[model samples]
Target: MSIRAIIADDESLMRSGLRLLLGAADDIEIIAEAAHGAEAIDLARELGPDLILMDIRMPVMNGLEATRTLMAQASHPEVLILTAFGTDEFVYQALRSGAAGYILKDTPPDELIHAVRAAANGTRTLSPSAVESLLGRGTTSATGLAGGGDGGAGPLGAGNPHTPDPLEPLTAREREIAEAVAQGMTNAQVARSLFVSTATVKTHLARIFYKLDVSTRVQLALLVNERR
Candidate 1:
């Protein structure tokens, strides 16, 4: 089945360009377009597209707010943030808002299509610059983005050995899976690398999420990065 998608952007030109580019993909379908976040949300409710290509800045509501609202729904389309901003703050906020993926507007068309597909498949995709921002190479530390309260010690309590490690509950295999996921490997890629089936990888991921008390792959990646 083709991946049904909606393009949400204030700029008509940008939306048209995206529609043209994504429409060319054999497996992707542009079902609708929204001028702002509010329209996007309403269309999502009505259309139930598989994914949404969202812009960060909009008139009525920004993409971050829209993403948060949509993700809070019991059933909602996957949100993939497409913006010109690759700053640490934007990347952190986008991930924190439950975006399935973040890519710069300048990204190659091929990679953008791949990101949309990966996101629809429940993979956490990020542009290389976004990954760098998440890795503490940017102005905002990874620990902060990971919801770390005390100084640099994240939710996993990295700096305090006295505090029990959050990842301790994971088994050897589970830890391996978590590590691969933190490296941004998709389920299929992780399965291929570990000589396991995609189903097995998914099973391990569920356990990893439960063991680590994380709901999203971005959270899992932050915890694993903090450990290193």
Candidate 2:
């Protein structure tokens, strides 16, 4: 079955251009389009697309609010932000709002298509570098640990604020998987890159998530990018 998608952008030309570009992907089908955030919400409930290409700025309601609202649903589609703003604040806000991924509007066509495919499988669209470029090197939690509420200290076992953060507890294999995911590779992509099965990739991701204390791939990307 094809991955259903809804394009939500205020500009008609932009929507048309995206429709043309996404048309090339065999597994993606454009089931609906919206000019604003509220309309996107309506369509999401009505069509239940697999993905939503969301814009930050829109009339009626903004994409951030809409994303939060839609995510509150029992069966929500993955939301991917497609916007010109790549600021760290915007990226953080979008991720916190439950967006699956954040990609700049200037991304190459090939990458954009790949991101859509990846997002269809619940993969994050932002590269680690892209996440870093947009936001500060900080953890999502108040404790500065990638995992929220966990006061993580480095291998040195020193809790002093001045002590360097302990190395993340990832095995060599898990590290490899995190690196690939930080680069915005999907589980299938990571599996192919590592010559492993998708099931194996998922297993590693679970371990990585527990080790890093991040629930989402975007936060994992941010954590890994900070180390680079």
Candidate 3:
């Protein structure tokens, strides 16, 4: 099936260019485009695309806030953050905001397309330029974003214990998977690194999500990275 997508940015030219490039992909379809974050949310609710290309610094609302809110609501789409700044802080914040992946705005067409496909498939990837910023970091260098977005409506907060230990519930194997994911490894890479099947990796991730009380991969990464 074709991967349905939405492009959310303030720049008309950026949106136009992305529309042209993504439109060329035979298996991809651009169902909607938004000029700012708030519109992105409304469009996401109406269209329910499989993926969203979110840009930071838009008027009315910013991508970070939009991503946080979208993942909090029902029918939330996977968010792939595209931003001008690839600093460590931005990467860490985006992941914590429940973005499925982070990529630089100026990334090459091929890699951008690949990132979109990966996000649709529940995988995380970084723009090559953004990779160096996070290379040696074992955990988040700053505070994590607001809670929820992973499971349900502010789900992590409602019943979570005061001073809750996010990783306390995970098994040794599940911890390994969470660490791999936090380090920005895709499922295929994690499987190869562990000498396991891709299916095994997904199985472990599901358990990790349940145990960690996160609804998405991005939130799980945030939890693991928070340990750092």
Candidate 4:
């Protein structure tokens, strides 16, 4: 099945570049292009593409606001945020606002295509460079490793011998389910892994979502990964 897509960016050149890159792929179809966020929003509402590649900074409206508006609808397509700089911190805002994926503007052509396909399929995607960029911001909240809390040096092990944080505390079973989720296992897959019924896994996930204060699996992954 071909994945219909809308490419949105402020620069015509970037849109053209995407057209050339993704248009060549066999499974993707570029249904529309928008030069600004407002136009992107209108086109998205009209075309109802499977995915949108959105640039964060644009005239008339920014990608972040546009994504929020687009995703407010009942059948919103996934939005994959794009940024000019790999180190840009706007990705966090996009993810928090319900964006499905994120990639830097300068990402390799092949990876961009893959990211788009992943977003279209309801899978979460993030450039590791983007994650490193956010970590480089020097926010104390990034590692939570500074001082009297646990004396842990960082997420990676150190000689400090400190206990890791539980971003969302879970019971043994909940932790097992969460690990399966982190591994990209669907509910059925999780059930098979745990030798439990799919209904049971769904029940656990509902409770986990509430306990973690996250609305979606993407948010759950982000919050849980941050803890580790």
Candidate 5:
């Protein structure tokens, strides 16, 4: 079946260009397009697309907020964040926004198509530029994930209380949702970003909270940031 998708970007020309490119692919289908985050959320809820190509910057609401709200729902879709900024903060924030992947706005057409397919098939794809940022550009940086300070480690294999637990237990989607909530996305925003309903993001949050033994969004955010 063709992968149904929505393009959520504030730029009309960009959206139109993407639509044209994806339209030629037999395995993909453009179900909708939105010029802003709010419209993207509304249209996704209405169309029920399988994937969303979300732009990080937009009017009315940003992609991060939208992704957060979308992921809070009960039946959210996969989100692939696209942004012009490849800064560490932006890339990290996007990953934490429940996006299945992150890609630069200037990504090659073929790679973007591959990312859509990957997201639809339950695989996460990070833009090469974003990955480079995550790994740090040069040596002499902190080696541990999310850094080792601030009690950032979870109870991982080392039996150390500070070590982060193995992330293998959680589904990719759940992990993504947890990360997004950690980045401070609202349920509505997650729902829109993931192309799912608000109730779905809430369900995911409940499960994540239980697993993390946290009671509120604030606690969850702290935990994820500490152990991310």
Candidate 6:
């Protein structure tokens, strides 16, 4: 099935550019566009698209606020934040808001499309620069941001001496999947490497996320990096 998506951005040119780029993908269909977060939320309710390509820093409601609102619902489209800002604050906030993925506008066209598709399929996506920002800051930097700090009690609680080893619960297969994901492999990539179906890989990933208590792929990668 083709993935239905909405492009939410304040700039007309940016939305147009995104439409042009995403339109080229055979499996992705652009259903509508929104100028701000509020409109995006309304359209999401009305259209029920599979994915929402959101932008931060809008006029009335910013993307982060919109993301938090949409995700709060029992059922909502996956939100993939596509923005120019890659600052640590924006990146952290977007992830915390339950964005399915975060990527800078400068991301390559191919990678951006992949991110949208992956997010639509319930996979976490993060641009290389975003991943770099998380890694550069180290896992502890997210302690306060992720509501950690009580000796490793949050999504990014790795590296805390008092925290039980997060990786302890993973079965060998789960560990392999986690490592592959941390290495930036998509679900499809991990599936191929493990000689399993994509659905199987996704199932493992879900379990991995629960066992590790991490929400975003960036957090999982950070924990894996800290381990290594």
**Largest lDDT belongs to which candidate?**
1
lDDT of 1 at 90: 87
Q: Candidate 4 — worst ten consecutive residues by lDDT sum?
A: 143-152
Residue 17 lDDT in model 1?
A: 98
Highest TM-score scorer: 3
Q: On a 0 to 100 scale, what is the lDDT of residue 180 in model 4?
A: 61
Summarize candidate 4's per-residue lDDT along 75-193 as a digit string, tens digits: 78899888875644676677767788778877888888888987887666777766565556532132221111111123321222264655436888998876566545678878987
Clashes of each: 0, 4, 2, 0, 34, 0
Output the better candidate (1/6) by TM-score: 1
lDDT of 5 at 135: 50
What tens digits encode model 3's per-residue C-alpha lDDT throughout 7-67?
A: 9999999999999999999989999999999999999998999999999889999999999
Please give, for residues 1-228, the per-residue lDDT of candidate 5 as tens digits: 999999999999999999999989999999999988888899989999999999988999999899888887878888888788888677667656667777887888998888888777644566666656755632111222221112222322223367766444567888887766544455776788799999998898888877765544434543555553
By summed lDDT, the worst window of 10 consecutive residues in model 6 runs over: 144-153
Rank by lDDT, highest first.
1, 6, 3, 2, 4, 5
* Candidate 2 positional error at 110, Å: 0.6
TM for every model, in the order presented, reads 0.74, 0.65, 0.76, 0.73, 0.65, 0.68
Model 1 per-residue lDDT tens digits across residues 1-228: 999999999999999999999999999999999999999999999999999999999999999999989977878898999999998788878886788888999999999999999888766677877867766543224333322111232233235556556688999999888777665566888889899999999999988877776667776766676564
Q: What's the C-alpha lDDT at position 166 in model 2?
A: 32
Residue range with the least summed lDDT across 10 consecutive positions in model 1: 145-154
Q: Predict model 6's lDDT versus the native.
A: 0.80
lDDT of all predictions, in order shown? 0.80, 0.75, 0.78, 0.74, 0.71, 0.80
Name the regions of candidate 5 deviating beyond 4 angstroms: 137-210, 213-228
State how far residue 19 of model 2 sits from its true place (Å). 0.7
Relative to the unseen true structure, what is the Cα RMSD of model 6? 7.2
